[model samples]
Structure formats: C-alpha cells, structure tokens
Target: MKKFCFAVLSAVMLFGFAHTSFAEDMSPKDIMIKNFFVNRVKDSKSESAMTLINESGQKRERKSTGVSKLQKNGIDNMRLIKFISPADVKGTSNLMIEHSDGDDDIWIYLPALKKVRRLVSSNKGDSFVGSDFSYADVIGYKVQDFEHKITGSENVDGVDCYVIESVPANNKVRQDNGLSKRKSWMRKDNFVTVKGENYDLSGELYKVFKASDIQFVDKENNKWQPMTIEMTNVQVNHKTIVHFSNYKVNTGIDEGYFSQRNLERE
Candidate 1:
C-alpha cells in the first residue's frame, strides 16, 4: 500500500474539504484561513445603520452604504463605504484595499475637506468614524498577521464553536492592530465568527464583539453572513451596533466603484 498527500490550494477548496473527517485534525492556521474567507463572495453590497452609544447612554445613529469586490487574484479585496445621513457626518467615506503580503491601504474622504486623506499603519487601531470598531476590525485582520491556537470549545447561542486564540506574529503587527491578543468563537459548522474578545496592549480585556442574525447569503457557495454586529468597549462602557439590510451578493460590482474618486462622491 502507498500513502499519498493532498494540498489545499484555494480557500473554496479548503472550505469544501473542511467538513470531512480531517476537520478535527486541521491546524489552527487552516481554521483561521477558513474563517477569514467564510463569507467571501465575488462582490457584495448592502445598506446599514450604525448606532453608537456613549458611556452616558447618549446615542447617535448613522446610515451608510457599502460595497466590496474581490480583485482578480480572488484573495485581495477592495471595499468602499459611504455615509448617507446625519448632516455632520454625511458625505464622509472610507476606502480600503487588502494586500496579500503587506499592509492594507486605507483612505478617508471628508466632505468639508473635499480631499482624500490616506491613513497610515499606525491608524489601524483608531476608531472607525468614531465607532467602537477600528479600521482593522472593519477590514478584518489577515490570517498571516497572527499566530493562532485552539484554546478550547464552547457554545455560542447554542451553536458549537471552536475557541481559537490569536496573538500578533510580531511587534509591528501588534502595534499596527493595537491588540496584544484576541480570542474568537468560530462556528464549527460554517466557520463564521460568532463572538470575539480583543485584548489591549497590556494584555487586558478591552472590548467584546458579537455577531448575530446569521443569514445564508450564498447558499450555492455555502457562505453565511451576519446581519448584525456589535462591539462594546468594556473599559469605557461604550458600544457600537451595526445592522445590515438589503444585502446583495455576487452582484458583479465594477472594480472602479472602489476608487478614491467614487469614495469622495457626495
């Protein structure tokens, strides 16, 4: 008898074989990779409302539209988000482009300035449009940016999940993300992240994140999307909740839509 070895060359193939008997034997890196691409579609668009609550219980609501599309390589992604309501923040937009081997590019357009400003790596941990979520959270952390290990298993909303802990791979990564470590509860069945805890530079709990109202957006591709996402700052007692609606996937969005010119449009 001869033994043979197989390699997972793509995210789709990796997901396809993840449900087999080898699931239990998969490495933490592979699991993270699967989670990163779980909801990866050719293109998607949606409208969402973000509610920000302060420690004093005051609330501010913002409406926005978002569009994302994968590049030709199918690994990198380009995203653009434009705020549509609230006179103070209206016409503000953000554009992000993912890089497979280096730092992601982020740009912000302010209606008042009428110019696009690029965000440096140090700004990755900064609040996204004054929300509890950061730029890194909006674009997502790259799988290779951290070292991951399965700490344990738990149930999230009655769904079994793998408790994976991730730490920055280097000091640069740590400073860029402003997180010393993070723990995520990834669904066992579909690899969607149901919950997460982000640790600060001092290794203390900083924020709690949760995702709910899961929807099977791309049934043909076995993809799942979360309709609601919440991030709470524990130390400050502030929170941000975003509810997404009217999600459209595989819409063949044009690549030019993510351009800086479009991002600055009113």
Candidate 2:
C-alpha cells in the first residue's frame, strides 16, 4: 500500500511540473499567434455601422456590408467592404487581398469618381475612408511583421490580460506601417486583444484602439468576436466606432466575391 501511494504521488508531481513548464515555455510571439488564429474564422459576413466623431463631437454615420474568406491556397485572406447608405458615399467599396508572404493588395471604388483605383500597399497607414482607423487597422497587421515581447500582465475590464509590446522588425516595415511601436492588452482566457495603443514615427501615442462587447460567434470552436471596436486618434481627437451585427461565420463564402470586379458591383 505504501509503495502504491508513493507511485501515485510521484506521477502527480511529474504531471504538475510538466504543465507548468509548458505554460512557461509559451513565448509572447506564440501567444500573439494564438490570438491571431483564434479570432479569425474560415469565412465571415457581417453588416456594420461606422460612426465618426470629430474633435468638436460632431458625428457622421456610414453603414456597410462586409465579407471575408480564406483564400483557396489557405495562406491568405480576401475581404470586401461595400457601402450601402449615406448619399455621398453610397456605392463606394474596397477590396483587400492579404498575402502571407508579401504586401497586401487593395482596390477602392468611389462612386463620385466612377473608377476603381488600386491603392499603394504602403499607404496602409492612411485613414480608412475618412475614419480614424487606418487600412492596417481594418485588415489587421500580420504577426510575422513584428517582434513581440510580453512587457507585463494586467487586468482589462476585470479580465486578466497579457500586456505585449511589438515593434517593427526592420526599417522598411517601420516605414510601411508608419508606426514605431504598438502595445496591446490581450485577454488571457480568450487570447483576444482588449485594448491597443499605436505609436507614430515620432514615437508619440497616435491612436488608441478598444474592443468591447465580445460575443462568442463560434462557441463550439471557442471563437470569440468583438461586437464593437473603436479607434480614437489621440493627436486629432477624432474617433471612429464600428458596431458589428448580423455576423455569420464559416458560411462557405465564395472566394470570387473578393475580386476587384466586385468592388464596382452595385
């Protein structure tokens, strides 16, 4: 009886040590990679309302429908956003094809111009459709493009989070994104970013990003999606609030829908 009890105790101790070691071995980059993969779905469709508030508190609203699909090659994502309302911006659309190995491709169609123009990939730092969010913010910054380290841990909205600091991996990337550094608070349980701070070329706080009203879009897959995302430009006191609704995930979106031809579709 004594030998049997000793064996059981030894087994328990070994298991505990192994678990702790595994947790400690996960680096900040691993955590960020997990966060990136967990939040993204194979395909998604949603309708969203974007509200832009200027320095004087004046507000303008735009509504749009968006669809995203993982490319057939399984290494990239293609997304399309089509504006549906507001007289001036109606029929405006943007299409983005995100590549894992190279710069993303973006095309925008403006109803006023009645032309589809391909945007410079490096112009991702520019404001997205006059909103506080940059193009990079909308399509997401690739995890491999930066080096991340865990600076500390804190609580965001009562949830424990890992505070990670990320910087551009090289001078070219730094210039492309127009950001010196970025910091994000990622929830420990879900690996979702609850808040983020962006620094400009001068290393000044340029924008603040906050995600709230998280909901489980795929409970079976343990996937959580934010219902509301807001980006505030600290220097300009401009803000954009995006509220997502009618979210559908993994609904077999057609890959052809992300093409530039669709950008001009009325």
Candidate 3:
C-alpha cells in the first residue's frame, strides 16, 4: 500500500502550489476543467476589484467606479488604482500590469491631466477601463496561451462544473487577436472559478466573470475564497458588483512592487 507522487510541476514551478494541470484520466469534469485555468493565474497578496462603467444607451446615464491593487504579479508591478466613478471622472488614476511586455501599459494618473497618460494598447481589442472589458481581456496567460481541452459538464451555480474551453493558439491569438474564446465553470470540491465568459473582437458577449460569496480566507483550512465579483458588461450594458472586501493571503508581495514608478506613486 504505497503510491506517492508529489511534484505537481515542482510544487507549481517552485512554491506556488495551486498550479493546476489535469487529464491523467480526468473526469470530475476534467478536474473541474483543470481547476479552472489553475485558479485563473493563482497568486495573490492583495486584490480588490470594483469596476462599473456604462457608456451607452445612456440611462444608467453613464457610470464609473474602479479601484484596484495587485502589487506583485511580476513584470514591474504596482496595480494601485482609484477612479471613484462619475461626478466628472472623479479623481482618475489607474496603473495596471505596469509593464512586463507592455501589453497593457495603462497609466493615467490625471489629477485633471496633471500628467501620466500612456495607455497605448494598439488594439489588443481595446476597451478595458470603460468596461466591456478588453485590454486582452484583463491581462493573463502563462504556460502558453491555450490548448487545455476538457469540454464537458455543467450546472454551474449548483455545482457540477468543469466545462473548459480555451482555444487560442496564435493566428495572433486565433484572429480575434487577444482573448477570443474562453469559457470555464470549474468546481468539483475546490479550485474555484465558478463561471466565466468573455468574447470580444466582434464576437459579442463581452464579459461575465462571476463568483459567489464563499468565505474561509484561511479558517484553519477548509480553503474557499471568493467574497464576490460580477462583471457583466455585455456590449456596454454595464454591470459591476465586485465586493471582495479586505482580503490578504500569502502577503509576500515584492517584485519591486511591479514598478513603473511604483505605478505612479502607489
């Protein structure tokens, strides 16, 4: 009675643990679609996202409110932002993924254009802060963009997920050129990512990243994390709930705090 194996990709490429990669015979719906893209790039010290931006069919009459901080995801970090929505663009300031490949080099710390405006995204399918989520569908990809396969299983909100579909192999990211196809549902007893949907570059259905309110930020261990988040934005219809309040996990943040002048003075 001995069968022990644990290298899980060198403990997730050296101490990250939640790495995720399935199909050794997969089926709890392919380990919940390989732990839903391995917890969608797991590794967090601090994250608080709240983005609400409506810019058409003017009846919510134009809205805005965004606040973020990811501090260390490498590539010169510092993602401390603030834009308290509306009221004439209330004190703008954003700095995300400051510059690794400079794919989404956003920086606009304008105390009324007091400087810092370099959001040159040549069209990674654009539109990130103004909602309808783009900017390469919010910066992500490591372990080579796509080719995971495990397409089967559903029922989402009531558990029983794992319907993975990620398809991007580079026709410049399959012609949509940035984050074209992605659909995940994951959750077979842990792993997270309860549902996701993103399709832009004229394929419609912009963003629908959902998740519920499960706690256990570290309650001795039953390990669950998702206080809330609900980015709608289906083609400028707008919807942002995100309420993950005061979270702190693993706290080790420091890759020079993802610099870019500390993301414009974090």
Model 3, runs deviating above 4 Å = 1-90, 94-107, 122-135, 138-150, 155-162, 169-171, 174-183, 186-193, 196-210, 213-227, 230-241, 244-266
Q: How far does residue 193 in candidate 1 sit from its true spot (Å)? A: 0.5
Deviation of model 1 at 163, angstroms: 0.2
Give the residue spans of candidate 1 off by over 4 A: 1-22
What tens-digit string does per-residue lDDT give for candidate 2 at 157-265? 9999999999999988898889999999999888889999999999999999999999888887667889999999999999999999999999987877877678899
Q: Clashing residue pairs, candidate 2? A: none
lDDT (0 to 1) per candidate: 0.87, 0.85, 0.53
RMSD of each: 4.8, 10.0, 17.4
lDDT of 3 by residue, 62-85 (tens): 232333333333222335455555
* Residue 46 of model 2, lDDT score: 97
The sequence of per-residue lDDT tens digits that candidate 1 reaches over residues 197-223 is 999999999999999999999998777
TM-score, structure 2 vs. true: 0.89
lDDT-sorted candidate list, best first: 1, 2, 3
Model 3: clashing residue pairs?
64-85, 76-258, 76-259, 77-257, 77-258, 77-259
In terms of TM-score, the best-performing candidate is: 1
Cα deviation at 20, candidate 2, in Å, is 13
